[model samples]
Target: NFEGTFNTGAYASWGPTVANRVPVHASGPYFIENYRAKSYAVHTNTPSSGAFRGFGVPQSAIAQETAFDLLADKVGIDRLEFRIRNALQNGLPTATGQIFEKGVGIKECLEAIQPHWARANAEARAFNAKANGSVIRKGVGLGSCWYGCGNTSLPNPSTIRFGIKADGTIVLHQGAMDIGQGSNTVITQIAADGLRVPVHSIKLIDGDTDLTPDCGKTSASRQTFVTGKAAQLAGEALRRQILRKANVSEAASLEFSDGLIKAYEGDTSVEIELTRLEPNAFGYVFMAEETYDPPVKALDEKGQGMPYAVYGYGAQLMELSVDTKLGTIKLDRITTAHDVGKAINPMLVEGQIEGGVAQGIGLALMEDYLPGRTENLHDYLIPTFGDMPEFVNLIIEVEDAEGPYGAKGLGEHVLIPTAPAILNALRDATGVIVAALPATPDKVMAALMAHNEE
Candidate 1:
């Protein structure tokens, strides 16, 4: 087996050289610099290395999150307060040296959790106060992060097909698979709105590589913003064509419902069946396609540049108790606030954020990957049902002008900042600083022994 050590602080940094020029000025003493350090580098000794769930994030997460805990202890500051002081705002620059043009919600997310955090911290402190001689000492922590939604600095794209069939039913051919994120359902909503037709009447053709156009991968949380918008644009193009043929003198705002267009003129209304219109009355039956690509620039030699078209932010807090003697950490509950730009699907967005938080908690407490044997899920360890606690969601809607329907990618961003936040809280609960990953029983025991001796 090949051995390698990844050090983030090794070099000044590489890539997107311009990110360093971006300014970060905050009112609080917490000043953040936009420094784009290399997140990771694959050693050549291995033929391949990657995984589903979280390919590279968990690896980097363990180190950075633990570092935050150390920083809080060294400065003798409340973990959450430190995080709030350094929280990223809309005008602030990112690590990659890019200035967020829109959809920045880091501060809003933290503010949303203020009440929950205050209550939880007080309850945790009071519980720990009574346990004078107990071996178990309870603790909690928090983490935050940012990431781009779609492919950056590389060619990535998505295409959507819209057609007015001979039968008059609006047909949509989506090039990307749903991948369990309800892509099909959302795209249908976009098409229905675009074509001015009922959602029930819109039947989407499954994503087939041969028949469909080149819409990039369904990953990176881009299906909604990219493919969804393409479908909407194509549908609108067709609707405009149909309206031209109706030859109505009066103009009206129209919406599609139940396979008909509801034309409204200041309370005066009329409904018309889309299929009943004369087939050849217009020159064309209306058909079109479109694609979307978030703007991004490649990183330069110093690891700085506008590497991402946009960035998403989140803040999360956790309450837990640790058995100082047994070295077992018990989490009470978690509250999270995320800026998702616009919740195109509110239910779906919440599900994504909550699910990611659970994974982040696992990373902070249990999930650990052995360098040599990466596939051992059982031994590698992950959180189970017993580990799950109450989850309070604080959803923030900040409209993104560049995103489709005021939307941005929420997939990866949900998990980025969670681990660090949890780790910070853990430090606050127990006067211990964990400097490594997993925080397993062995590690916790060692840290506790050292603390006691000191």
Candidate 2:
């Protein structure tokens, strides 16, 4: 028989303890169950809760994924198999009672990771069965969670402008920022392909509010899909305008390439330079602009809504070692699989995954907030070079029709499953379970002590 248990946690929002109302926020109530107990951010004399790298997914994964490893050990099931059996699919209902509309790849992700997981799990098990002779036990664990690709319940939109200059160059203007994730490059690619122009012929003016359209913030992985589409539509519109102004026949299609507009059936072609395409310039012809808006709704008191326009999924496996005495954890290797719908840039997607895993490692063994306070990054520690582990980044490309070229956002999906995976491995190695974030030496030691006492 197939079986699984799902748990969730919530954050309580009391507007400062002095406020005379019960905090009805979903977060406080949501995480307590996942934490195997309750945790409250009582309207303290301090600050409130907010989103970070992994959002609510990280908090939830940290608890349930740890529990998953414990459950796997008890059932004697392969960890990977355990995950696949319970992996959320497209039609599955989420804990919040919402059905996924499209682009769910939780199963696909598990399938992609099967081979690597088998090999890694074998190595971890073999080493644990017979290796260093000590109280220290080496194990492997995993963590995974689901979240929509962009801002949920928040207004998400993008606008872009495309114009052809007198010199035949294509100019694209957008409000998206690069921030190191290649947003600018991808937007240019979409415009070039749409206008039929050489990639290099497109000049992108982006992230300047005064010079570009309102493309929304760069936080969510929405730029490439949302803003990129706007750029493409604008380019297509400009292409139509050019043909209309040139009085070309319907059959006189124009091929856009290398900044040149050529009559499809004739030797006539004109190279347009972006500088010469200024609206104030003589003979400057076509201009087009467009905006994109996806349907979304607000959740009522139930803490539900079309929070995400689209969702991205992933699965991961970890091979790790825990020194029972030293109370230190070592991550030997990690195999991560994600469904990105389309990898506009495979390298870029890999980068996003790798970076996210780094953050995950931090959450599992290094990152921590000072007790009773969320402020001060200086006081809050995150993983550094000492924590980097071997990573097997796997990109499971499943074309998402709503995304650009079938590409969905890969930004936040990578980190969700890592901590749990590692924690599970730890349980496998030592037959002991630690339930909390940053399973530090002190915490692990405490668990070991408690186990020995038992």
RMSD for each of the candidates:
5.6, 6.0
Every candidate's lDDT = 0.65, 0.67
Task: Put down candidate 1 lDDT per residue, 1-454, tens digits, no spaces.
Answer: 1111333232323212112211111111122563323333433443333333433443454455566557776899866676677766666656545666567777777778878877887777777889878765556667665555665566576777777644455668887787777778777787787776678887778678876777778766567777776777777776676566443323557655444655676767666675665444221245677776667677677645665565566767777777777777777788878777777678888888877877877877888765567777777777777787788887888777666677777776677666666666657766776778667777878987888899
Q: Which candidate is the best by lDDT?
A: 2
Residue-level lDDT for 153 in candidate 1 = 60
The number of clashing residue pairs in model 1 is 39
**The CA-based lDDT of model 1 is what?**
0.65
TM-score of 2: 0.81
- Residue-level lDDT for 428 in candidate 2: 74
Clashes of each: 39, 38
Worst 10 residues of 2 by lDDT: 17-26
